[model samples]
Target chain A: MNKIFEVPLYAYERSSDQDAATAVRHKVIVIGAGPVGLATAIDLAQQGVEVVVLDDNDKVSFGSRAICFSQRTLDIADRLGAGSPMVDKGVQWNVGKVFFDNRQVYEFNLQPDTGYANPAFINLQQYYFENALVDRVRQLQAAGAPIEIRGRNKVEAIGTHDSHVVLEVETPEGPYNVEADWLIACDGANSPTRRMLGLDFDGRVFEDNFLIADVVMEADFPTERWFWFDPPFNRGQSALLHKQPDNVWRIDLQLGWDIDKEREKRPENVIPRLKAMLGEDVDFDLEWVSIYTFQCRRMERFRHGRVLFAGDSAHQVSPFGAMGANSGIQDADNLCWKLKLVLDGKAPEILLDSYSRERVQAADANIAKSSRSTDFITPKSQISRLLRDAVLDLSEHFEFARPLVNSGRLSTPCTYQDSSLSSADALNGPDITRPGSACPDAPLGDEFLLPKLAGKFTLLTIDAGAPERIEEGGVEATRLALSVKDDLTLELKRRYLGDATGAVYLIRPDQHVAARRDTFEENAFRQAIRRATGKE
Target chain B: MADLILTPNLDSADDFYAGLLAAHDGLDKSASDALNARLVLVLANHIGDADVLTQAVKAAALRGS
Candidate 1:
């Protein structure tokens, strides 16, 4: 085991709130100090919103879980001030190879073109990711941000009121009561908070089990994602190998439905399997071993009155596509800005409803893609297996069949195409930057485009005329003017202005395009800001 | 999108039928099923247009019923 997990980073320290005679009411209380919870708190605190985070544990997670982080996630982390450390400690890879029965079928490059600031994906241990986030929280605290993280403070009961939520928390001292104007539950999949509220997820539970083994070894395998289907070593099942930082390799092997999970996880049974895959001469030590059965499900709604759910507490999917944690981080990204507006009374409370609507749409998309991948990887019926194997076999010979072979589709950022907040798109710009799409990164001399749009409504003007700032219904959108003549790389023109000579884009604080037009008009831009902030 | 060819398009219909039957002559139930799946996939790829495939699938389902 790693030494990082042994030492408590945020040890149990008594807080003044625990000793207060009456239940202390906080502006916002976030449950579970995992990645999503920490991100929510950090985003809120950075915007000067007071938030309190409570967790049942004090240290990072025990194992290298959720090792694959997508570029969109890195972009969000960059805005939160934790991107540099994570990127520094992560293994970046863009190439992935698919193998069938000991022969490589085809390889893919995730990042074919590179003018962006981040790579397509980075492999970092979940513990390191969490530690980076917690470190960011500490930095914010030192800078006098109104955020507090309490360890060993677990909420056991929850009561939803008309205007606030009351929670009965259990700590080392005893049980005490706390109140919050709003509650955000980032507790994990088996969320006690969700259960206390009598909520459940509605979707399919796959009938296959997977064994995840993290081993420390020095090997010569290239830093790329390698997935095998029905290999000789693991006959009739699938296996995935990925490189992580610190010489830790993540290996996932598919185990059929009816097996003793405990026996399969034993080192005695695991070492032989490793020896078969990596020849008998290779020496390695098992760092962590676990078995997981996955489901593609989510809550009916993420927000219920004043209580909200984020991360694994609201949705879950199989680990095949790395969608679980990536989508959860996006949940934090979609939520914090709207929550900030609601708390500050700049926008109507119904604006938070769009968070649930949009994220639930995103969750459904993740679930659909994940479910299809699971079906392709683990065929349920004889006919389905025959078709799947046929695809794999033909892929080795035919170019068209290669696309039919499904290892895992991997994850991409979700675009809120039908979001109510998005105004009519009239720019005829690149589809990648249309209304409701996450703004793709482009080069602007030494800086990138996403960082310039960080955490505020900005009017991104390209060879167009716009005011320095536009205020609508108490929401402000500042201008970020650019010209194609200054873009030596032409990436901004290619990504933002496909055929139009000039473009103006209204970008939300979450870095999603709210509206775009060929040219700026004051009345239209002002109405777009109002629509995006839920004032309309 | 073109409609599925319901008319006689095969140059030698009997010959094609004979060849398909010969392909599955000695195979058992499972092997024959596997072979049929591969053949279907091959033909589907050959007729790559999605609209034509949907029409053919609907026609085949109606015939089966």
Candidate 2:
């Protein structure tokens, strides 16, 4: 077992709230101190909103769950001042190979079109990711930010009201009552908070189960994602291999339905399977073993009255694509700024509705992609399996069929093209960074563009003139002007400017493009800011 | 909209049919079905037009009915 899992990072401690006569009203109370919950608290606290995080456990997650973190997730983490540790400790890789029946079909490199500060994907243990977030929370606490994380503080019940939410929290010492003007639930799938509210989590539950084993060994396998379809060791089933820190190799083997899960997860059965795949001569130690059945599902709506849900509590996807944690961090990124605006009376509560609309769109996209990947990996019907195998067979010898062989369509940030918060595009820029698209990063001198646009609304002008600052309807956007001459690589021009010589873009606080034009007209830019802030 | 080429586009239709049958001559039922599926995918890639594929699928389905 990993040493990180045995230590309690956030052990229970007595608080004054437990001794108070009446319930203490906080500005925001977040349930579950997983990646999503900690991120929400940190973002809110960084923006000067008082937020409290409550979790039933006092430590990071036990296993190496959610190992693949996408580039967008790293970007968000960087803005929250927690990206450095994760990037430093993560095993970064972009190459993936797919195999069919013990033979390699094809390989792919997920290199981005242009340079980015973060890699395409990084494989790190979920414990390290959560520990990094918890460390960031501690730093913020030391800096006097209004953030609190209560360990072993479980919310037994919740009451939703018109303006406030009352939570009945149980601690190791005793039970206490608390009130919050707003409640955000990041409690993960099988969320107790969700059950307390009686909200239905509806979607397709895949019948097959996957046995995940994290083995520590000294091996010669390269640090790349290798997926096998029906290998000899696991006949008629798929398998995946990924490298993590501390010499831990995460192996996932498909265990078809109708097996005793307990028997399958035991070391007696699991060790033999590992030996068969990794030869009997190889020596290894098992770190963790478990079985999981993934479901691609989400709630009908994320926001309900004074309570809102983010991350797995609101949505889930199959584990193949690593969509679960990456999307959850994005949920926090999409939500925090709007929530801060609503809390400060700078924007109406309807601004939060756009969060639901946009994130639901993102969730649907993930679910669709994940479902298709799951079907390709585990075909339910005979004809479907035949078609899948045909693609795999043709892919080994042909280029066209390679695209059809879906091991897993890796996670990418979704673009909200139809968002109400985005204005119509007037500049014919590259579709990759058009209105409602996340801003692709470009090298500016020795620095990067995304870090400069962090945590605030920015007006990005390239050889275009705009005011230093524009404020409309209680929201302000500052200009960050850059000229084409500064971009020696011309990557900025290629990504943000196609044929247009000059352009101005209104960027949301989350770094998504809200609007763009050939030149900055004050009236249009002001209206764009208003629309982006949900004041239109 | 481009429709499926139901007309006489293939000049050596009988030759092509004979070649396909020869490819599947030694295969069992399962292997024959797999071969047919692979053929469909290869041809679909050759004719990559979505409208043409849709029309071809509709025409094939109507014949089956």
Please, what are the lDDT tens digits per residue for candidate 2 over residues A1-536?
53887899899999798888999999999999999999999999999999999999999998898899998999999999999999999997778888888788888887755668888778999999999999999999999999999999999999999999999999999899999999999999898988999998997655468899899888676778888998888887899988999889999998887779989888989988898776799888898998987667899999998989999999988887888999999999999999999988899999999999999999999888887887898888999999999999998889899888887777899898999999999998899998889898888878888999999999999999999998887788999999877778888899899999999999998999999999999999999988888888
**Model 1 per-residue lDDT tens digits across residues A249-329:** 999999877889999999989899888776799878898998977667899899999989999899998887788889989
Q: After superposition, how far is residue A136 of candidate 1 from its true place, in Å?
A: 0.8
Among these predictions, the greatest TM-score belongs to 2
Q: Which ten residues in a row have the lowest lDDT in candidate 2 chain A?
A: A107-116
lDDT of 1: 0.89
Winner by DockQ:
2
In model 2, which regions exceed 4 Å deviation? A107-114, A205-207, B1-6
Report the TM-score of candidate 1, chain B only.
Answer: 0.93
Native contacts retained, all candidates in order: 0.41, 0.88
Clashing pairs in 1: none
TM-score, model 1 to reference: 0.94
